[model samples]
Target chain A: MIGKLNRNSTLLSSIISIILGMLVGAIAMLLSGYDPISAYGALFSSVFGSASDMGETLRTITPLIFAGLAVALAFRTGMFNIGVEGQLVIGSLAAAFVGLKLELPPVLHAIVALVVGALAGAIWALIPGLLKAIRGVHEVIVCIMMNWIALFLSNYMVGKVLSNNSDSTEKIHPSASIRVDFLTDMFDGARVHLGLILAILTTIFVYVLLFRTKLGYELRAVGLNPDASEYAGMSVKRNIILSMMISGGIAGLAGAVELLGTSEYLAINPSLPGTGFDGIAVALLGANTPIGVVLSSMLFGGLFNGGSNMQYVAEVPFEVIRIVFAAIILFVAANFVKQLGNRKNRKKKGEKASA
Target chain B: MLSTMTNLLETTILYSTPLILAALGGLFSERSGVINIGLEGLMTIGAFTSAVVAINTGSPWIGLLAGIVAGILLALIHAVATVTFNADQTVSGVAINFLAAGLAVYLVKALYDGAGQTPVVESKFTDLAIPVLKDIPLIGDPLFNTSPITYIALILVFVSYFVLYRTPFGMRLRAVGEHPHATETAGVSVVKMRYVAVLISGALAAIGGATLSTSIGSEFSATTVAGQGFIAIAALIFGKWKPFGVLGAAAFFGFSVALSLTGQVWGLTEYVPSEILTMLPYVLTILALAGFVGRANAPAAIGKLYERGSR
Candidate 1:
């Protein structure tokens, strides 16, 4: 069927684009007065160098997978959720606030903190979603504005609201931490925690929610053709809002996972975390699929983990990896361009045949 | 009291020039049926190029030219991806932002052996005071004693208005944005018009970037341009895509930034955090979009790729 063929091509295109991305990175390094092969070699060796290094890579990938799924879910529903950065910030702040302040049993403490964080993200996303559904406002503009607001507000909270007269808060209680003793021992005292296991489980949950549920079917239907979906007795507006809330909640959960699993305290960020923005690249390279997002995120995790080693051994900047990610998106979107041309040509041929 | 008012006026003008130039550039591209969210990246390219050239050549003029060229080159890549290949404009724009940030920092480390800064330039664009005009009561000193780009930015608004409404090229460009099929039927190539528009945007945006390095007392750093490009987009929408309207919007946003910077001297920072003060422009922008502008009509085919004989 045409649908199956299209899906295969999309998957094929994602793989090809990633290779192109690496090639582009290599060429960029060569031009910048560095040896491409050695830079990449140092990069891989550092990623796989030791158990602690691998644990660090997994820690980084854990947040990325959650954020990537957040973006991919929105992409499948035809909404561009550019506010993931803002959502994640609020989510983390909420988690940190509750984890440090609340008193409860150990497991209950962690659960409450994560739920509150996800709820905060959902509430933040709810504003733009509601505006888009009810008032016909563009979500992109609203989200961009909200991003700055969140950045400022969170910075304020960390500095003034929750601070014990310092810029950063005290660490959260041990009861709320997600670190697992066995995992840390296995990785030789690495900061690897239960967050990785949670991330994998969330990935499976998202996959099922997207492809194996009636709500998922309706959400896709609305995305493909809102008018048809509306005629078929679906509430297009409700689905839009629901999809955005779910997307935001996942991004919020990413914030909780990262905070409880690793740092255990929120520091005053000089800028918004790059994890949310990087998620867009991960989603695009994965072709917006659950399994694909995990695999692609692992590759990205390795690259970032190895970036410092590349810098240390080969004198190549870590920015070279950022450039490579940008290149991959460019090549992947290039397929959309080619498809546009083909669609027009086919339409022309069809008209001619009818005449 | 009069001195404070004049000082505020001067800062507002200084803050608004880059924004005005960038918004005007966005006006041209969006009017021609292409949504260029990469104006920020183009401005970054412009800022970095100008600063480096000015530092080496010791001439701000030559640096300005190099900055413009850098912006054009980046815009060309965007055009190839979006206009030729029919890529998603927003995604392409985001890519450009990443590419510009990474490449600029990478080159800075390579060339300067620093984290992400260029060497300070010896020559900067100096402010010029008009002889008689600068002495006129309250507005004179602030309005007349500004750099060359300030005057040029104001002139560009009128010039864009003239070209967009009076010239044949402008008509075709607008026509393409509203209805590409009509423009194609009338023998204008929609693709060519869009390419030209996007390139013009790049040139103007680069000049905006140049102002940051050459006029503002700051060296080129990773955060030099900040989010000015996005602010320019906000201005474009606030102005409802009109050249004069964009000028007004840019000035208003610029006023907010000026207030934030000078709030400490003005004693307003005591009541508000600088972070919150810095967020005023963005907050106002959101309010402006949510029904304050009444009705905003973007070019119908703004984000769509043109195809022959297709609706």
Candidate 2:
């Protein structure tokens, strides 16, 4: 029982540990001849400095929000959808194809592109989900493999089948591009676009769906304990597949937004954007909640944008951000373990005392 | 058609070396209930270390040892996190990946004097032709004449299979993965077994990375491994995590890459986009995992955090 309390205290200690970690990092920076305060000031100011910086930060957060939501949703249902990267890639390709080929009013075209992208993502994700539900293959292995396939397939399509005048897809028609003029005017020329609004709406939708709907309940129940849910007469298999598909669709939307709103076309060597993998960190930090994912995504976005600027101005390597991210993950994962251990210990103690 | 076959065989040997080694590494860790998702990162570290060492020492063999040592040290970190501290296996694995990547790039810039890549080593592993075997019509040149790593990879496959299925240590490792409590009752130390498994995983993965630098490229770049470690994981699952099965899957993937590269040489690109051909291996891997490989049952307690006094 004493051991349990100590374990629980570890969670509290983790918080203290994180602060200590920052101090350690600060000391190291000082020893390295860097002004920690100035570096941090630059990081924050570059992220929230001018309106333009803020706009770029928001722009970076847009896809992260969608990817984070995708990961979080699957996580909530006890599924590890590592294939979000693949889903995002395929989704973006689908959106870019539609944006370039389709002719419609601006609003309708954007909607169509986004929908197509989501549907493409859902379809790609559904394969692994169905396999897990019906055949008992683990989603982790399946998702990771699918991500690679999606990457190669998208790269191939953009470089070959969908190639326009260049080694990339044709630029989307004016009607298909998301209007960033408002953001441009607001920031005196920033790249933020309507994707941010869509991301927010999706967050609210995810929150409501997870907390308010019967489907959400079933999904969560299945995630918590599949056998228990089955004993309670829920179709665990169907729910698992559904959760994966929905998550995939959300990830797909992230890709679509990136292509249509940000890049305006698909480049053959489109930088992986890292949105899918970053979503993993975001989801974990957010505790897999809608609001949590949104906030976490923003924080990550800030770090990314700030890190880039730090590279440019402070001569700090952008890789430092990765180390920071890893440290945070280590800190949080350790805290979670401590909390679980403490809870289990406390439960045991309470039972023994009552008996 | 004959030339195509020879090219395919050569490509298969080239592609399979890393996959086979990495999958063997994963087999060691996962069969003992520790999921080593850091295989990719470990491979990257190994590749970077070997590249640098070879450049300095002018000996690919020394570089190989360096790679393995680096891998073992990194694996020790994972062992501490998952085995000693009982951290979440998946997240810790992911953190290791990030740390390895960040550290490698940072060190490369710092140690290599701001070059994002290592100096190309003159002492690369050379392809060896088995005298008589090399004379065999089509099969000899492609399969028999290869870098030493190919021979090591092939031998390791059987060795791994024997270790996992036919050895006492293998039984204990399997026992721990399947039922730690029962294994403990039987007088086995679960933590010790897991630590060993994870370290072996690291060593094997690093060998794969070293092979890449010494045999294939002779230098290390940021994206050197390029998610091949994850691909090995996929191959492992698709092969049902068996040594021979993984070999087959790796070879299958190798064939795809080989075919794609060969397609360019064969002028097949005039009809089909080379990019489409390049997508074949990844596409096939997904398909295999989704259904082609059938159902794969992971070890019980695969990712659970084991507590000493829980029971």
Candidate 3:
């Protein structure tokens, strides 16, 4: 497999994977005695039901976009940052701490909280990156361990250090909140905030960083062929650590955005957040590209938003979305349509090979 | 203090059984040139199967068998995808984890009148005390007076060590992982070896799940297999992929888990928060890999797709 996928081939494979995933999900629903049509109908219809629905859908998409970008960046840099869940929680904790404890001007408070949160996530990721670069430890093993540590540490801090008489911290000060009153009014009181605008801006920023910058070129070169990059006088270790920190920063930003714009506080989480895990599927489906991640996140965000509707209308658990995504991931991995890609490329003067 | 030590040892052995079983399973797959990160998913399915079957049939033994069969079926998918189609093993593994996590809970809800967890099975493994062994002052109670599964798991470690190191099949398995092309030239069917290894890996990992549900945990829930599958992987790395080493590593992890709880009783929680205490196993895993153990000595051909054309 080459380091990057050809656009035409990737588009075809992604479509086929989504179709196959839906088919399998349908079969599963039928076997379970649930009505697949009604369930799926309820899922999408809910996303388009009203202005409020649209706003809520945007809210769901916000964190996923950040998460997808985080995963995509790491994928581009030849590392699997599965510790995103840990980083996100730690970032949220940091943001909540900042938002609650600090006093600052309205614009400055939110900005400062966001920066601190992203830095928290970056620091969490730095450990595994450093270990992989310096000690030759597998990043996956260390990341998985860190996920648990992050969870427990955050859980302790949330319940003991941050609790304001209940399971969650007190709502953040209004100065630190990213809630946009005009957007809220337009969406009929839905909690749509500045996070969506931030998401789109970040996507464009990632595109420019990866495609039009010297550092991005060096980082991806190291990812594709570390030995060759090292021979070319690039510092592979430094690149590895740098990319991990950036990926982690985005992951932290995801947590920070959700805390500031939506949840507005931190709660005791019993399990690792699924959004961090979902980033893997998003990146893979997007072919690890910036713009592609936004599109993929949009699709996933719709499915997830409609999940509650599926529960209410068709009596199916929202978890079916996970199963469908899992199947899609499997199909993507198998690359069943690679032959199609190969055949199409054969007639071209310069054909790109695929994984 | 001796009594406390014995109690702690008892808890350690009690908890380590599942890790020993799962890590041993991981050894087989990695030894045959496949990376099986789906141990968590396989265990989740196993835990679900055993819980459901045991609740229905009133026999944990039958439940255990069904769990194993379920694991083999799921592993066949992994084998076909990764071994036959050359899919990325890690991708396949991540897919399996999500699939199992969602499916088991969904099925439980469907089968149990919308309940989120399986009803606790009435037919559970009873703790046993080997008569004479149980009488030995300190070691006996801690080591011998526990579930029968613990004894079987300990015995299997030596059995696994012998099978991997001394037996012809074991040698062939290791050879494929180390040098599949050489093994292919020598007339061993690399594909068949890998398929067998992956399937065995699934079965043993399932047993680990079964141990949790029927032998120890008593029920299947969304959190039943939680992160035990991942912990088993850490144990595999800590053990350095050797059978005896794996056994020791699994035991060490189990001790960490047990100590997380027992330390509270001993007033150690006064210094360390309970949540921090619970993080011991995970933290130790990272620490060991980073500096204490240095690099992991993974099999040479692990995570690589063996293309017959290249061979």
Stretches off by above 4 angstroms in model 2 are A1-41, A164-166, A270-272, A336-355, B1-4, B129-131, B269-273, B286-295, B309-311
Q: Per-residue error at B158 for model 2, in Å?
A: 2.6
Per-residue lDDT of candidate 2, residues A226-309 (tens digit): 999999999998998999999999999999998888889887653355668788888877778898788778877998899788
Which docking band does candidate 3 fall into? medium
Off by over 4 Å in 3: A1-5, A164-167, A339-355, B1-3
Which pairs clash in the backbone of model 2? none
- Tell me the lDDT of model 3 at A312: 83
lDDT of 1 by residue, B1-311 (tens): 77888888889999899999999988989998888778888888888999889988999899999999999898888888888887878778878888887777778887886467887877989888889998899999889988988998999999999999999999998998899998899999999999999999999999999999889755898888888888888888888899998999899888887887788787887798777877787777776667765666677888887778887
Error of 3 at B57 (Å): 0.6
lDDT of 3: 0.87
Best-fitting candidate, measured by lDDT? 3
For candidate 1, lDDT tens digit of each residue in A1-355? 9999988778777777778888989998888788999999999998978988888888878998988998888878778787888898888999999988888899999999999989988888887888789876777777777777887788888888888547788899999989989999888787989989988998999889988999988888888899999999999899989988998999888888888888999877656686777888788878789998998899888888898779998888888888888888788876743466587999999999999
TM-score of chain A of 1: 0.92
Q: How much DockQ does model 2 earn?
A: 0.54
**DockQ per candidate:** 0.64, 0.54, 0.68
Better of 1 and 2 by DockQ: 1
TM-score of candidate 1 relative to the true fold: 0.94
Candidate 2 CAPRI grade: medium
- Docking tier of model 1: it is medium
